[model samples]
Every structure is written in C-alpha cells, then in structure tokens.
Target chain A: MISPIGWFIIWLGILFDILGTIGLVRFPDVYNRLQASTKCVTLGTFGIMVGIFLLKGFSPMGIKALICGAFLLLTSPVAAHALMKGSLHFGTKMWKGSVVDKYGEDKLGGEQIEKEG
Target chain B: MRYVLYFIIGFCLWLLLTLSVNLDHLIVGVVVVLLGTVLFGGYFTDKPIKFLQIHRLFWFIVYIPVFIWYMFQANIDVAYRALHPERPIKPGIVKIKTTLKTNIAKVFLANSITLTPGTMTCEIDGDYLYIHWIWVQSELVDKASEIIASRFEKWLRRIFE
Candidate 1:
C-alpha cells in the first residue's frame, strides 16, 4: 500500500498528465502543443515514477522505476528538441499570437543544420 | 578512464536490478560490466571527468533541489495557462546567447531550459540558442538570455566549464 504522501504525489503527477493532455488539445500550433505536452509529460512521468519508488522502497521494481525515471528525464528533452527542429524545417506556421521568430529570421535553414547534423 | 566509470555504473545498476547479496551476482555483474564496458566505453568522452571534480560535484549536489524547484514552478506555470479561461500566452521564438563553452554544458543548459518555466530550446548554434517561449518577456537578446538561461547557466558553468 502506498503511503499517504506517495499517494498525494502520484495524484499530483496524474493531474499534471491530464493537464498536459488538455494542453495538447487546446494549444494553437504544433510548436506550442509539442512543448506543452513534452515538458508536462516528462515531469508528470518522473513524479509518478518517483512516487512509485517511494511506495515500493528498495525492491528491484522500485529501483527500475528510478532508472526509468532518469532515462525519461535525459531523453525527453532531446526528443522535444528534435521534434522542434523537424517542425521548424518543415515550416510549420507559428501561432498568430506569437511575438517573434528568431529561428526563421537568421537560420540558414536545412542545409547548414544537416552539414553539422 | 571512461571504462572505469562505465564499470562502476554498470555494477551499481546490476546490484540495484538484483537487489541481492550473493557472490554469484557479484561475479556475473563484474564479468558482464567488464565485457560491456570494453565494447561500448570508447563511445563516451573522458572530458566529463572534469565535471566530477570535488567543487563541481558539490555544485551538482546543490543544483538538484534548485532544478527541482524550478521544474515544479514550470509545471505550475503550464497548469495556470492551460486552465485559464483565456489561455493567456504570448508565444515566440527568441534568440539568446549562452556563455558556456562546452557542448556538454550547453546540452545541460538546453535541457534545463526545456524543463524550466515557459522556455524550450529550438536550436543551438555555437554561442546562440534559439528558444520557443510561452511568454516573450523581452525581445532583446541580451535581456532574453538573462531571463531564460541565466539561472541554470550560472550553475552549469560552475559544474561543467
């Protein structure tokens, strides 16, 4: 059985996950949706995993949860970055509420990135 | 040197995975870790060792709580915007300069920015990082880096640079 504190954390993570889904549905454009979902889900899953680790203590399963959480933390940002880069190169339009676009302004676009990529 | 680090990491991971105390586990883990390290350790850089120095390690330990607090704030920031009736947001892609020199440090800086409130790195080009921000607080590059990267950049510089 999960302690009350662990339960609370798990619930909090669930709430964040739901909110991220809401953001995915509600946000205006691909970039907005991508970032909103990525960050929230990363933190959400991490929180839940840590909560599970708390609930399970020193069990092998518990340690795996911690390892999985660390992997998520390390990988999700790279995924977000790659997606964002792909979206930009694909020329996905930014939302109208956007104030600026430094990416489009000075970037040499696909060629330079691929050479270094 | 990198193999040594890999061996230690793999051995610890094996111990955690088994959660056991046995000579057999130890022998198997050592053999497996050694073989694994020999095969893959060449891929990793020895440069990260500088990051493991005493003062830098101390900064890393101190940095964790700070990072978690910012991450918590970032989540709350997202929730507030997502839940608000108007979805108050001023999205933009802005350019910012990072003073940190190393690729690893810049990567850490970029990841930290993504996890922090309202900013995600779109591209990293040399000293400049283009960021997608939920709120465009300042259009000026200097001011923007000050806002977006300064907090974590300071700590990252201490640890990695």
Candidate 2:
C-alpha cells in the first residue's frame, strides 16, 4: 500500500503541473511562458518520479524512477537553453515590460537571422 | 586507473538499466564496461589520479544536497513570480563574470545557472555570461554574479579543479 506521504507528494506534483499550465496562459509573452513551462513542469515531473519511488521502495520500478529523476535533472535545462536560443534567433519578441536586452546589443542576435539551419 | 573509474560508472549504468543479477548479465556488464573503458576512459581524463581525488569526491557528495536545496528554492521563487497577481517580473539579460578558468567548470556553471530560478544563461563570451533573469533586481555584474552563481561556483571549482 502507498503511504500517505507518497500520495501527498503526488498531489504536490499535480498542483505544480496545474500552476505551470496557469503560468503558460497568464504570463505576458513567449519568454515568460517558456520559463513557467520549463521550470514548473520539470519540477513537477521530478516530484512525480520521486513519489513513485517512495511508493515502490527499492523495487526495479522504483530504481527506474530514480534514474528518470536524474535524467530529468540533467536534460531539462539543456532543452530550455535550446528553446531560448531558437526563440531569440527567430525574433519571437520579449515582453515590452522587459527591462534589458543584452542580446539586442550583441552582434550574434542579428547574425542568426540570415543563417539557415 | 582511469579505466577503473570508467568500468565502475559503466557497470552502475548497466545495473541500473537492466535491474538484473544473473551471472550472464554480470558477465555482459563486465564485457561492456571493459570495452567502454578501452574506447573512452582516456577521453574523460588524462590524469586518472587527479580525477579520482578523494577531496573532489567528498566535495561532490557535499554538493548534491546543497544543489537539491537550491533547486527547491528556485522552484518556489519562480512559482511565486509565475502565479502572483501582479506577476512582478522585471525580465532582463545581464552580463555576469565567472572566476572559473576551465572549460568543464564553465560548462557546469552555465548548466547550474540555467537550472536555477529567476536566471537563465543565454550566452557565454569569454569570462562573461549573459543571463536572462526573470527579475532584474540589480544591474551590476558583480552583484548579479553573487546572487545567481555564488551558491554553486565554490563547490564546482572544488570538484572541477
């Protein structure tokens, strides 16, 4: 039987997923949306994996969940980096309220526009 | 010696992936790790002794819990900004400099920054990293670096150096 703590952790993951979805809709622009989806959903998924591990203890499925947790930790940020680069390259535009644009000042920002991938 | 490190890592991965303890599986794991070590061990480190330093391993063990704590903090911080009624975000790309000298250290720093809340590493030029921060609390590079990287940098240096 799954313990109460395991169920609670699963609920927390669901909550985070819901918050991420809300963030995607509520945030001002693509960049903000990306932040919400990447950070929140990744953490939420990690939580679910941990919860599964808790429920299963040292069984094979539990060990698999732990491995998945490690993979999620390593890969999520790389995926976020790629998404940010692609969005910037395509000139998707940031929120007008944004206070700074270091990329706009850099030559690389414009260079990406002409290159074909 | 480097081959030993490679074998251990490879065996661990094999064990994790297969979740098996049969003699045939054990033999297969030994073969895979041996072949893998022959092919890739030297590529990871030229000085096996340096790479396997006890001090570095200790630091890595210490770092894991600290990193997890930071991850939790980051999630809460971002969740607050994402959910707040005002959405008090002052997003900006700020340049922050690193004291780390090695390429691997720099890579680790960049990945850590990207993972943490409020900041994302967009570009790295020499000693400077341009980060996209969700909340632009400070404009100074030193201040930004202190806020974003100070937690992870010292431990990373210990491990990578």
Candidate 3:
C-alpha cells in the first residue's frame, strides 16, 4: 500500500546514506569524515524514517520509526561535537594546504613551537 | 498565551502520533504537556510574539527535499570512505565564514554542518565557523561555509527567525 512517493523518498534516503559513506572514504581526515557522515546520515535517516512512517501509517512500527528519527537527529550532532572536541584536545593538526586556522593562534597560545624550542 | 498555544500544539502532536482517545491517556497527556509548557515558560522573556508570516513557513516544506538530496549524496560518500582499507583521510581544521546573523540561524547552520558526514562545526565566533573537515579537497573550508550559508541558512531563517 505504499505510495510511489514514499518509495522514492526511501530510495533517496538510501542514496544519501551511501554517498555519506563514500565521502567518509574519500575525505582526507577524521574531521572531514565526521562532517561527511554526521550531517548526511542524520538527515538521510530522517528521510527514510519519514518514508517508513508514511507507508506504515500510525502503527507501532511507524511510531518506533519516528522515535528513532528523532533520536538520530538529536544525538548525531552532539556526538560529532564530542569527537571534534576530543580531536582538538588531543592536538590533531590541520592539513598543510589549509589556508586559514582561525583557532591556531588562540588555541595554540600564539607561540610557535619552533621558536620556543 | 504563547505557552497555552504551545501546550495545545504539544498535546495535539501527542494525540495524533499516539492516536489514542482513551480518557486516561488524554488526561495524562494534557497534564504532562501543560506542565512542560509551564516549566518552559520560565525560560522566555516577556517579549511579544513576533509576527511570523505563514507564507515564509511554506518555504521550509519546499527546502526539505533539497536537504534530503544533499544528505543522500553525503551519506554514500561517507560510507564508501569508511569501507576503504586505505582510509584516505586528509584531516584538518578550517575557518569558515558565515552570513547568518541570528543565533538561531547560526545554531541551525552548526547543527546542519555537524549532521552532514565528514565535517564538524568545532566553534562559532561571531560570523565565523571553525569547521573541522576530514579532507581538504581544494579550498574545502571556503566551500563549506558557502554551502552552509547558501544551502541551509536562507531556509532556516524563514522557518525559525
């Protein structure tokens, strides 16, 4: 009884999920991969869950789907934030080609390690 | 009045999703939702509600599909990278400038950036977003900021601000 639109949305979600995974692989580092995975997967999952809800109507399954979607939306970004904070705390370096590091002077105390050493 | 409206909306949402009209559930839901609204009332200042245009809200619905499509593309990209044994990661932090002026829009952009795979909004100072990217694909930092402001900011401004 699922409408074509529902199926299409589900397919779109699947496609996003796949693309996010690919971005994670092709991306240069942990932070970049986190960016690729967290944003895309969260929204992608939401879309799929919405599709499921529409197809299943107001059944328990649909309710569970909605809950899952909400949980993902709420927690995924928080988790990403934690990961980034952890990486920064642990002294992860930026790529060399990176043009700007706004936090570098502030975060690293504005003292060049080479000069101090 | 706003609290009352919120309570009603919360109760209606609960009822619609739960699809239960049993007297016990209705009473409990109403009590809980009203209590939540009462608790939330303490957080807001006594400012009057800003006049929000209904037409602006409609754009959010239109933007949803675009967000979905972008998400789909990001998902596949992340999944493939994860499976790769080589783990071609270029990890780095980049400063991304944002045009969103309001706190809500900045929050939305930060959350949106975090939600997308391979990027995280590490910090937001004024109009700048300190984003950590997994890869530095060309001018990745500039691209990210532009993407956030252009793709999501306008819609979020419409919906919440």
In terms of lDDT, the poorest run of 10 residues in model 1 chain B is B43-52
**For every candidate structure, what is the RMSD over all alpha carbons to the true structure, in angstroms?**
4.6, 4.2, 4.8
Top lDDT hit = 1
Candidate 3 lDDT over A1-117, as tens digits, reads 577777888887887777677766666555665677776677778889989988887787888788788768768887888887787667776544344454666576541112211
lDDT of 1 by residue, A1-117 (tens): 567778788889999999989988888888888877987898899999999999988788889999999889889999999999998987777877777887887874422212111
Q: Candidate 1 on B1-161: residue-level lDDT in tens? A: 77788788888888888888899998988899899999998876657588367998899889988998898899889888888999998888889999999888899999999988999999999999999999889989999989999988889988887
DockQ winner among the candidates? 1
| Residue A65 Cα positional deviation in candidate 3, in Å, after optimal superposition | 2.3
lDDT measured at residue B90 in model 2 versus the true structure, 0 to 100: 81
Second chain alone, TM-score for each candidate:
0.87, 0.82, 0.80
TM-score of each: 0.89, 0.85, 0.73
The ten-residue window of minimal lDDT in model 1 chain A covers A108-117
* Range of the 10 consecutive residues with the lowest summed lDDT in candidate 3 chain B: B43-52
- List interface RMSDs for the candidates, in order: 1.1, 1.3, 4.2
- Give each candidate's fraction of reference contacts reproduced: 0.75, 0.59, 0.52
Q: List candidate 3 segments past 4 Å from native.
A: A1-33, A36-48, A86-101, A110-117, B42-52, B84-86, B137-144
Segments of candidate 1 deviating more than 4 angstroms: A108-117, B21-40
Best by TM-score: 1
Lowest lDDT 10-residue stretch of candidate 3 chain A: A108-117
